[model samples]
Target: MVWGLTPLFVHQRILPVECWYPFDEKRKYVYETLYFIQILAQGQIGQVFGNGSGVYVVLITLICGQYDILFCSLKNVLYTAEINSGVSAELLRGKQLAVDKEKEELNQYFVSKETFENLDNLDQRLVKRNLRNATKDALNECIRHHQGIVKVCTLLEEFYNPFCLVKSLQMTVQLCFLVFVSVNTTASVLKSLNLAQYLFMTLCELFIFTYLGQVLKVQSLKTADALFRCDWYLLDLDIRKNLLIFLPIAIRPVQMTSAKFSGMDTQRLRAILTQAFSFFTLLQSLT
Candidate 1:
């Protein structure tokens, strides 16, 4: 039952890694999780780690689901790092190119009428004129890269929106069940690693998704500052106006959520913990 439903809930990501980062697009992927329940769907259901019911039927899904979310979070963190490096590099490179072009332009126009005649020889003036003629370029690579980063964030929100919703629903039901088992079969539940493992896996899975989204949001906010530091004033007037488009995006910020319920972050994680305990308490009181 869990096997078939996993993929429907998973949705992977919208744009593959290649679409977001050049390095990721170029590098071949290996040892990556294809979906949430690959092993179980491969006829390993009754035989996860060569164990049966109290283990196989339960632990495999819990552990695999936990692992899937964790792996996704780790990849997201790495991807964000690549994005930061790319953004920084492109911003600096474009600024330097702008500076070089500015120097060449300065050669054509007098820095000041007094300073131009003070040059020792024509060769000094010639270098600036020749370099200006040579450095003729109009480009803003940073904007394109920022667009890519924004796309990644957009896709991430799309991919994980459904994921967090389904998982929240799944966890609510799963935790309620765990609370029941822990209440009614306290000794048996304590004795079995499988049962305890399920609880641990639930918390860990929730932590990874919420925390990763939170970090992504935090980093996305930093891009605004990165954009400001990119020497936009030095860019051509047209280019500077075009660069202003990023300002709105940065100010509003990028974020992911659990079905629009809340921002996925440490606060969300804390709320989940509180809800779990509250659920456990409500369950205990009823019993």
Candidate 2:
């Protein structure tokens, strides 16, 4: 709002935007009216940016939150399956301890009497079958969740990719001109401050998008890593086979892009700033 009224402090009549007008703007009443119009238009533009960017950030944040939840879900699926399948951890541990003890005792020409009782107490085959089925079911559920996330991403891409493309193009030009103008000329302190604020705002907006894009990409790719870090080796052969099939698909990273022309990441931000600098350098040389 303060930026929109910058003309008020200039001590001379001016409009927020300079453009060709059909009528004279220097007339006392005409100047006041046009000045009011320009300030109001600028204010409206500010409002759109404030509110629209909030919504944009929220949607992206929600998507990122979902990715986080999916990661936790994938990591815990096996443990959850074991719990749900009523697998007794105590019995498994007892059986393992018995087998180890028996091995040690046999080397000393002694067999422990408790080893036979421990081995007979556990229904190992039934436990294994139940765990396998539970794990398979859990994996299937996780796959469905993954599919849902993919669909949401597709929808987001379709709706926002074009907007991102336009925003990137607009900011590229705006940053280039802003840098050129700021460097090439002298201005009043207030004007310089205003330009700096505008430049900062533009950079901040771009940073948000690129940073979030990078975050989404990282979180999406980590899904596979999370799965791999789980106890897959202990899983049944059939369950491992299912995971082997799903691992490659999970390994593919999700990247947010601008109409498929460019990705929205730190690298993209670097490219944009580089392009803007090149323009600034060229304009400086020409002048």
Candidate 3:
């Protein structure tokens, strides 16, 4: 029962179509890979991940390629949500500034025209600066009221932590096995080619995950910059302190991990590819 239902079960329960729908071609890896996977499923082919790739090269090629595309599709979509929300916050800040300027201009009519003209140039400059800062402070308060910082952070952490752990485990196993296959001189040409294809897919997936993780980190840190950009310097000490409450947390970067341990960044991805290639070279030399 489980064998017959594996494809449907994985699609409905594990990998939904909606996950990949939001991503563009740039974000979605290798559309042909997904197509091949579906073809393998429809043909009722034998398992690909089994030890006997030499006996089932066609099935293995389709299976590995398809699963690779499936896995990488959502790495960007998951974090894009947080990034968009942060951008919206920045836009709100700019709008608030514009509204405050209009209000100040409206209030200027109350000041007597003679009194405003009589002020010295230096005093006028200082008064203008004070008005601008005060307006910004009020606007920052409104921005803070609307921010969902806690909610965004919580959801990101909850989703990223466990997802990377499972991916790391699965990739680790695939990497080890691929290396083993590469070293086996007795392996058929078709077997070697299938292993190489799978290795390429694995590398692509790792690159996608780490790249998206880095993007997420950068986007989250930009929120901190947005917070600091506010006119906290001119507000009263008490009000300033409130504005600063979330600033420190915002400044701290958000990161996704590989297996709940090491950070998933481009640096790590480079190391992985380097090591995989180096090992492949060593095995070739031995052969």
* The best candidate in terms of TM-score: 2
Better of 1 and 3 by lDDT: 1
Q: Write the per-residue lDDT of candidate 1 for residues 167-213, one digit (tens) a residue.
A: 66666667777767866785432234455676777776676666666
lDDT, candidate 1, residue 172? 65
Candidate 1 lDDT: 0.49
TM-score of each: 0.49, 0.81, 0.44
Error of 3 at 254 (Å): 1.7
Question: Stretches of candidate 2 above 4 Å error?
Answer: 87-129
Which candidate wins on lDDT? 2
lDDT of 2 by residue, 70-171 (tens): 665676677657654766767545545655543442221111122222334344544454766788888888888888887888788787788788878878
Off by over 4 Å in 3: 1-150, 186-192, 230-238, 270-287
lDDT of each: 0.49, 0.77, 0.48
RMSD (CA, Å), candidate 1 to true, equals 19.5
66-106: candidate 3 lDDT, tens digit per residue: 32222222222212222222323444345435554333422
Candidate 2 RMSD computed on C-alpha atoms after optimal superposition onto the true structure: 11.3
